[model samples]
Target: MPSTRSQVDTLESGLPYDYTDDEFDPDYRESSEEEEDEVPKTMQRDRAKWIEDNVEDIEFLYRQLMRDGRSMFGDSFLQTGTINTFANFLYRNTTPFSEA
Candidate 1:
């Protein structure tokens, strides 16, 4: 075990913020656990909200891509023959509705 005189000196120096050797007990552990448990509920709610918003944005982008792609490619680019035609079709479909 460490010397009490060194521990007292360390405490007096205030080098460890609010912590000290004397404060370490079962009650401290229980309080820390309770604080930790409180965090997950808030984090889970934020995560769920973030996922919901992202899913909505993704769906919107998918629908927009489908609509604009069909318009630019005439819905029959896949059926067309020749590499040039397919290349032109691909190039034409490259421009998305959103600039950014």
Candidate 2:
């Protein structure tokens, strides 16, 4: 059994005394690479499904904004320059329209 102090040290360090640096190990690297390859396909499919499910709500919000003649951002929301700037900002900063 580990002493209380040793357990505390392990918790503080966020690692066990017997922990090996598997990152540099070839077997570990190969398994991680396989995981990485599988991750993107799953992520993309999930993202697409989320977008599909929410698209109607998104469109409804846009229509409401247009009908009310109110810009959620500000009074200048309808201006082309403001729209361009906002679009550019969103494109640069957001991931897959999530931020907007």
List the global CA lDDT of all models. Answer: 0.47, 0.48
> What is the overall TM-score of model 2 with all chains considered together?
0.27
Indicate which candidate wins on TM-score: 2
Could you tell me which residue pairs clash in candidate 2?
Answer: none
Clashes of each: 0, 0
lDDT (0-100) at residue 52 of candidate 2?
Answer: 65
**Residues 1-100, candidate 1, lDDT per residue (tens digit)?**
8766633434556675455554676566434633432324434455445445556554565556566767998776444344333332333344242111
Residue runs of model 2 more than 4 Å from their true location after superposition: 1-42, 69-100
RMSD (Å) per prediction: 20.6, 13.0
lDDT of 2 by residue, 1-100 (tens): 8666633435556775554677767776444633422324435565556546656665565556555665556666555433323333333344463321
